[model samples]
Target chain A: MTVDLRRAPAEKAVAWRRSPAGPPRASQKRQTVIRQRQYWGRLFVLPAVVLVSLLIIVPSIQGLYYSFTNWNGRSATWVGLDNYINGIFLSPDFARIALNSVCVVLSVPFGVALSVIVANLLANNLWGRAWFRGIYFLPIALSWVVIGITFAYLLSGRGPINGLLSSVGLGMFSQDWLGGETSALISIILVFNWSYFGINVVLLFTGMTTADASITEAARLDGAHGVKMFFNIVIPQVRRYVELCLILTMAAAITSIFALIYTMTSGGPGVSTTTLEYALYTRSFSLGHFSQGAAFGILLFLISLVFAVVRLRAGVKADDD
Target chain B: MTDRNSTIETDTSNDVPLSATPPRVAPPRSSSAAHRTGGRRVGDRISALFSTGLTRIVLVGLAAGTIAPLVFMVFKSLTKQDGTNAVTFDAWAAVLNGKLPQAGLISLQVSVIAILVILSIATLAAFGFAKLSFTGSQPIMATIIVLMLVPGQTFIITEYFNFSHLGLIGNIPAVGVLYGVTQIPFATFILTNFFRAIPDELVEAAIIDGASYPRVFWSIFLPLARPAMVTVGVLAFIGVWNDLLIALLFLPTPGSRTLSVVMAGAQDTRTFDVSQVMAGSLLSAIPCIIVYVIFQRQIAVGLTAGTGK
Candidate 1:
């Protein structure tokens, strides 16, 4: 690819030479221009990369290194493995948060599948498809904070869900959704799905639009109707899109704050919704164990990195084939 | 799942494909079946219209449902019941009075500053990435892609200490710098792709006229990259404005708290002014929506361009 990018000038030169007007001198001039462009292109991208390095990458590395040390947020003295030891082996919160993170991850695939099914219906050009698509996607752009607040309202004992339930004579099912430990994690996961499904729906809808109709037709001709055609033909065609959505959602899920937890429960009735990001925040900023926070952050980073690597490697391999 | 046959056949029957046409499945040629269903009857047209109406109704209902919370929030901001459980403009007025507690003014200031700084850095970085390719360019690009893929929270704790040790804790600059930094990976990624989409030949033509890299960037690429720039700006603004965890950790001081932190803490209280809370929420949302509206066209175009590329 680099060689091709470099040879673009030469390729252009040949094209100019083969033109009907036969502008030989112009082609030579064009050749010089291409050579110059290559030089300039490199210069243009330098500043952004430098800033990215300084702000994101360097601090990340520092954090990773600090994760191995026992330095306070204020002082700089490294005691190797102390922070990590405290964070992982000793801290039960780590295990609970890890479990919470797992729960977060698990919700996304279910959400993705639901969104795709909804997206397929929207894509079918049935009545009001565009409006449905818009509705589904509206929440995608909302801040997690806002969603948390909204869901907090909805899930409250005095909130609308409870109000409606009592009105419908099913008040027994309505409990303190965000208050109970067991239900809090489930509530937040459900909120996440509601918030994110729109985006997945949009991506899937777009992917469905691009799906070759002939492929579906071919399936139909082969006696593959309905579910078979959808699963075998349509789903396979949109695998790349599904993967994209999955990776994006996974990344978001890992990094996302416990906004609802912060708002409604405060990581209680007992740390039920304390996600990796939330746990890191509390340990560092709230608890003032800066080193421990940094260590947890590194652990969170590593976990996210593992998932990211798998996603990227898969994408690259698919691209190659 | 509904039969894919009905949907696919109906869809394709209306619009034909241009290439690699598939074999068509003919409808059953039975007059008896048609008669049973009253095919070609006036009622069929009415039923089709009825289904269309039903779909529209459902769509409208869902759209309303989706937007209702936001709408209610705005309404809640305007109604004044009391200091607590009240939905009124008083909360908004109080916030605007500039005497409100830690979260309001500071959050607004921090968010504004963060957006400006992020936009500047991202735009510059995008310009560089899109138009220039230095040595080891492939690796740098790959690194960026990797960075973007990595969940942003991975580095927050490190960044917290990095800034704190640098005496940037509770500092507005630290907040801005952190927001700007995390956003760079994605902003640069999106913008670079945008920059790349500008025909190379156009840049070469500018150079041929003796225009320098800076000159070409200013005159040609900048104008053409407007759609992309807007998209980046909107995304950056939204991300920075809506950010909570980072701000909560870094800007821990009462005076430095962003609105999210303020709201998060406020929920712990017994008697809350729901109206004021709604107002604050609306305030947070307004800027994002404004940016979205202003750049909607460009965002759409940029999104399509990014997806296509």
Candidate 2:
């Protein structure tokens, strides 16, 4: 379907004549073209390779080395395994941070389940489906800082949530949502779910759209409607999407909630809501424990590596299918 | 051609006749049974109506929950901070005239530069990976994937050391370059997938017409890949614009802080004005919301690219 505007008749005639008599010359030209293509290909990718090496790959290797040493930003002394043993095995603060991280990671299932229900509801030809999708996804556009600041106000002692609760005579249920230890972590988890719900819904809704429409219609006719059909048929069809949602949510919870924790509670009620990533920030930047921070970073990387392997395996399986 | 023809043959083979299988035999019987069980039908209909009504109510509630914080934010931004119910623009004025404009300008500069860097490098690398076969491509891509998988925090401390060694701390363009490089893996993944979907015939025809590889990429693939490029650029823009960690760590100076870093700092001080802070948060969110609204479709396509068929 491509327009061959540059292939003039004279050039074609010459190529035809040359090809019949000089096959070796034509092959040589092809080899030259291939070599040139290879050259250009390497050149094309050169900048990206250079930048990534300088910024990510080299720094990561350095970080791995630093984790085994007492590198306080400027100076380093070889103290192998000291940082890791103390940071992971001995410190009480590390236990709290690790537990908080686990709590965040455990919240992924609830977020995914809620997204699935909402996505299925919206997948039906409901009224104003597009508007609803937009509304749900609007939070993804806001930075975590914005969401965190807004929620910080909303969860404050005299905020609108409590105000409304008191107005409705449910005043006993009201408290400072982010002021206590357990409640602070719980509030952070809830906010994380709320902010990430939009993207998950969009992803799952896209998956639902890809389901075989005729099969669902047939199922509906056969009295397989509502919750039964959704669990048995729709979810099975979109299992890849559900897995994807889980992987993404886990990754976000593990590595990307620093801004959220920083803004909302500042990891407060005394490190109650401090995730590993936030702990790394405070340890290295706040407390000037660079090597300990690097150790935490390594631990976080190992955890993410598990999810990454799972995701890659799913990708390969999907490709084969 | 052989592949296409074989697929067509398989498609035809899959189209078995409906008459060869028993079909619609249960539907007619079910319809008759429904007629005999009129009360049961009414009960089913009532339950269905009730379920749909309940679904509608839940949907409305969810939508309200989603939009409530934003509404509250706007309300807080407008209301006077002196315990009065009257609406005032003082918060907006404070945000507009204060450090917000400076921070906003820095954010724009960083995001724009980062987007340009990401688009240029990512498109080239994607084209190479998608169309040009060369030695070590697989290993390089594998390394990139590994880098992508490892969280950015894994390298933050070392990056700080390296940047400080190079005296790039507080440098805006350097920070932009870091953001661009960090996003290259995802951007290249998106664009490579998009470029692979393009028919190879176009490249073959262009090469036969004596076009060089770069010319073919420049004149053919580049124009065709505009939508993918836009998606990558928008995503990169939002990412760099919304980042807090890099901005906070790299640019620690008061004058060099981004909007997010400024807001983070504002939230820390004890004696801050609540309305002004709300206005600042709203101001920072508007540009990203506008971008998301306009490119909503492309964004959805970009986000769901690898997970779907």
* Per-candidate alpha-carbon RMSD to the true structure: 6.6, 6.4
The number of the candidate with the highest lDDT is 2
Query: Mind listing the fnat for each candidate?
Result: 0.48, 0.68
> Which digits, one per residue and each the tens of the lDDT, describe model 2 over residues A149-195?
99998888988889999999999989999999999999999999998
**TM-score to true structure, per model:** 0.80, 0.90
Error of 2 at B100 (Å): 0.1
iRMS (Å) per candidate: 6.0, 6.5
On TM-score, the leading prediction is 2
* Isolated chain A TM-score, each model: 0.84, 0.90
lDDT (Cα, 0-100) at A223 in candidate 1:
45
CAPRI-style docking class of model 1 based on DockQ = acceptable
User: What's the lDDT for candidate 1?
Assistant: 0.69
Predicted candidate 1 versus true structure: per-residue lDDT over A141-240, tens digit per residue: 5677777777788788887778889899998999989888888889888877777777777777787887777766555554454455566567766666
Deviation from native of the Cα of residue A130 in model 2, angstroms: 1.0
